[model samples]
Target: MSAKTATARPDTSKPPKKGSLHHVVQVHYLFTLPILIMYLVFFIVPMFMGIFYSFTDWSGLSSQFNFVGFDNYGKIFQDDDFINALLFNLKYTVALVIGTLVVSLILALLMNQKIPFRTGFRSIFFFPAVLSGITVGLIWNELFLKVVPVFGQTLGIDILSKSMLGNATTAFWAVLIVNLWQGCATPTVLLIAGLQSVPKDLYEAATIDGANAWQRFKAITVPFLLPIINIVIITTTKAGLTIFDYIKALTDGGPNKATRAVGLLIYNDAMQGGKFSYAVAESMILFILVAIVSFFTIKGTSNKEAGDA
Candidate 1:
């Protein structure tokens, strides 16, 4: 009877081997497959292709080209259009980073207070950020071309009489202003988030210690806000460096190309002028410039914060 009761049981001993395709398909692959596929098809492939093409004189159309190494890079230094665009980009970046930070920080501080209709005000301020870059550019284009001219005619003001985009001297400023208006909204929101995340106990403690408002801000607020500030600066700088959509939509690198940014220059070179290889090379240079600027900015701000602490 005891022998007859003994029975075989099913084995539940081990897991599937990770190296098996079946295991991969059944476990982690589904979750990460889409992102990995997209990354490979879009970013990784394009980057390598761009780098390879940069050394060649390949037209955007055909594969036939000479691989003249370093020639494109050397020629860039002598290219006046590229050089001017680079310089203009630098100036635009500086103005954007400084102006956005100043305006956004102020707005963020003001918005942080327990004021009436603060939520409504935030919506109003952030409204522009949701608009299409091209659409915003077109709207501002009308303001500059039509509305401003009408005001100028009524007031007998000379500078506002013409389309600001048509004037080389003022075109750069007009583009910068439009970008500043659109750009500041995002940074303000980010700074508002940063301000909200700050612990209130530190402020309370400082207040109890006879700290004035300015002193408390200087001592506690700035230190805490430094990380967000640096993040804003980096992102803003990158935007300025790679500025394209607004400039393209608004100016199209016109008014004698005075408002031509590096982005426009590259786009014109690749798409418009059919100098794809040269454009790729120029893009590489811009990449280096962006990296250097970001590194220095982050290093400087972080060091300053550490010293203050």
Candidate 2:
């Protein structure tokens, strides 16, 4: 026993190695490297290049070009076509955002009820979102051009057979309608999720308190769904701003460019007229517009939420 009573010494010579910290950092870098590389290569580089080229008179295909400074931007503002196109895009964004939100919310409410074949109805509503935007546009074009006429002939309704893509006013509305049809599906799905997340107990309590359906919805559902509504509006606005495929397919920014949006205008400027620098300037404007809109929309919604809270 006496021989085994040796004093124990503390081993405090060096700090413990942070192997776990190193592992965690390595894991994070490994996970993020690919995405960072992709962003640098695809988005960051192109954006800088576009900005650089915007100051120069580069016609895309040619190597020989000269610096033009703010001339392209000045021309963009002066061009009636550009102004009209921007206005058209703004109108399109407003119309699509409002229409899609309202329609999708209604559909979500209906589907949330105890209806027959709810899954089938959901699928029917969402099927359009699965189709390519160009495909949906083309299909709607045919319907407006061919099927509408046949249906009108059968029913003897002259208004039903009119060329939707012919006149400026009608063409704009036609594109808006097609956009609503194609885009409403995703918003509906989102609204469905939001609706489902809402507490059923709130409705039950409201009913017990002698509240009518409209009062309950106004006081409860709308308040709770505000976040989702904001999301839908932002998504639809961005989509509307950058809309190209459907416009290209359905109207080709035609009928005197009445239905043209910003994306389509940029594409036309770059590809058709060989105005690469001009298009880049237009794109920069668009990017600024989208960034401002998104920031304000999000900030407004956030402020509303804070006020309500």
Candidate 3:
């Protein structure tokens, strides 16, 4: 009665032999080793070094420095320029995200329709994305400074006759419009791809069920595009927060520092003022803010997507 048959279990105890497929597969990892090393050396190392410097008083050119604990971080909060920059960044991010999302989604929907010359239209809209932000800004800056005034004079319109960048009240809108023009292109392409991925059958069924255009969009299109929308939100938020080239080219944070973005501030402080450690501290705060915003955006979208599923 005590003599029971034992079933033999397959053995995974032995390691793969040399020259085995498993070993060969592992060798593939070696192909990526160089890239990994480069990333560690160039990016990770510098990031840590910057963080270390942020806690010290390094004038960037100085060979010697002193650690000042949280002095930089504490000073940043008390700085009025920093506060103004932070507020402007928040305003810019909100406007950029909203405008870009809405305009991109609209353009995507239009492009997705069976319209004449859709490909040409798509190309035209996406062309702006290929141009550098600085280039675009410079172009638009000239247009606002020169071309628009001519049109305004011809039409006898006062507001249109002046360079918007030269006015504090209109500078924000001008910057926003320029950013939206270039920024909408990539998001439009993304939303188009997302739109194409949605099952046509769902729309057809919804139509058959007497769902109106808005209803169908709300119930089906929105859910399918949630992931792409989330991506657009996070990316645009980051771009808006770290905006520099455009401001540099367009206004240089001009019109009484009305549009001094955090990125530009960091650049000016580090390079122009030689306050490298302070700039690093600003960058760290910017990084943390971006991380928090991205985390919440992803978490909220993922939850909604999961609930829909």
Identify the leading candidate in terms of lDDT.
Answer: 3
Per-residue alpha-carbon lDDT of candidate 2 for residues 1-309, written as tens digits (9 for 90 to 100): 644433222233554544344544678789999999999999999999999999999888897999988999999999998999999998888888889988999999999999899999999999999899999999998888978767867898765667778878888888888998879999899889888888899999999999999999999988878887888888899998999998898989889878888898888788786788999999999999999989988997897676442
What is the alpha-carbon RMSD of candidate 1 to the true structure?
A: 7.5
TM-score versus the correct structure, for each prediction:
0.83, 0.87, 0.88
Candidate 1, 143-223: lDDT as tens digits = 998798888788998877787789987788788888878888988998898788778998999899999999988988887
What are the Cα lDDT values of the candidates?
Answer: 0.86, 0.87, 0.90
Candidate 1 regions with alpha-carbon error over 4 angstroms: 1-26, 150-162, 295-309
Listed per candidate, the RMSD to the true structure in angstroms reads 7.5, 7.2, 5.6
Worst 10 residues of 3 by lDDT: 1-10
- Give the TM-score comparing model 2 with the true structure, all chains together: 0.87
**lDDT of predicted model 3:** 0.90
Q: With candidate 1 superimposed using the best TM-score fit, by how many Å does residue 251's alpha carbon deviate from the native?
A: 1.2
Q: Which sections of candidate 3 miss by over 4 Å?
A: 1-18, 21-26, 154-158, 304-309
Better of 2 and 3 by lDDT: 3
Sort order, lDDT high to low: 3, 2, 1
